[model samples]
Target: MPKSLQGLTVLVTRPAHQASRFQQLLAAEGAHAVLFPVVEICPPDDLAALTAQLVDIATYDTALFISANAVDYGLKALATPQILHHLTLGAIGKKTAQALQQHGFTAQWVPTAGFTSEDWLALPQTQQLAGRRILIFRGAGGRELLADTLRQRGATVTQVDVYQRVCPKIAVSQLKQHHEQQQLDIIAVTSSEGILNLVAMLDNPAWIKTLSLLVGSPRMRETARQAGFDGTLIMADNPSDEAMLQALIQWAQE
Candidate 1:
């Protein structure tokens, strides 16, 4: 395989816990990855509430996970895997499904293409939901589209937050230092909120607008553009590490 990213420096703005795999991918391509975590994934404020929600897992006919963190924290809170056997598992993204598989669970439904709530909502199985009780496992303060749509379809939707997505205290000087040295080539942002957080963390952020901005989806790309990013915007096929790596390699080759 070709080291397509040789001598390049990419800024990785994923959460600290999830940055390792992407960093390793960049390193394998001979690119330097500068870790600048914009979002911090932390346990929810109330563990008892999370545990209580899972205690009634059998009541819900369907269970949907929003992200990998949701799958991890949600299952961890459950502790008893047998309780989940009654619920039909669903994951918003492939990564979330993989996370469930790691926990000895399988997602019966995953979106066909995209990794957003819209994609999952579009499924035929999700429609005609009259009296199906659904439980959503996700982080705090995410989009309400999934729950709203399900409820609109007459499904009893309950959202149980298992994790918290907090904006970490960021020192943009680390990024600025790389920019000053002209070492920052591209900045990778996974979520729409992450790009917003990165921009908010910087004082001027004009320098970063000049660099290539890599995003996972069109929604995220639009978010970056709305945040005043004027440089080249690269959209990965999906938010997965492999997708982002392939996107970077293809961009470099072109």
Candidate 2:
């Protein structure tokens, strides 16, 4: 007689623009969605620099997109449209490739399994990067692991900053009220940055000691631990909404 997430209250900390779909999916399964957006996705301050990178985009041998956000926001910064037709494209996963399709572009390469840079790097096409020039479109403050690995493989990797993440100023009273009243059941964190932001917002309370946490990956779990949350973290198979919901259901059943 129980729903998958019946009577459970889930707190999702994804960016405001990106939270609606995930909330809808959780709500469909009978979980009460608590929307507390901690991050604001915005345009980078330096538009000129973004345009400068795209000015010579056609010369690059490959262009890599880190996320769907990157594909949507990054391509519009280009100086011209025809340049995309000339370069080989790479997407981190299916959603990003879908975003590219919306933009009338296609990725020649995508990581088949596992949607991380480590997984993408495992592809045979990525191994032969010698003398290749790659343009990476992504948000600011992204990890250097991908670019670094590509450079070490004898590729010229250029990164264009498309968007920036700004942590919003959420009132502590709201979070404390939910925590005090026990309305906040599980907090789903999508990224390492989101994990740290949630820590700063909640101020590392004793409530976290009893709280159930959901992380998109093991990397996020380690980051949450470093942020003073040593509580148990339920990890999703991947970062998609479906995967996170599946993890949530699995945890609830246990």
Query: Per-residue alpha-carbon lDDT of model 1 for 144-199, expressed as tens digits?
Result: 99999999999999999999998898677767888898888999999999988887
Q: Which pairs clash inside model 2?
A: none
Candidate 1 ranges with C-alpha deviation above 4 Å: none
lDDT score of residue 130 within candidate 2 = 90
Once fitted onto the true fold, the runs of candidate 2 whose alpha carbons sit more than 4 angstroms away are none
List the candidates' TM-scores in order: 0.95, 0.95
* Model 2 C-alpha lDDT per residue in residues 1-254, reported as the tens digit of each score: 76788888998889988899999989888999989987778989988878877888877979999999998788778767658878899998888888999889989889878888898899899997899999999999999999999999999989998999888887778777888897988999899998777766777666764677898888988887777775668999887888999999999889
* Local distance difference test values of all predictions, in order: 0.88, 0.86
Q: In model 1, which range of ten residues has the least summed lDDT?
A: 199-208
Error of 2 at 191 (Å): 0.4
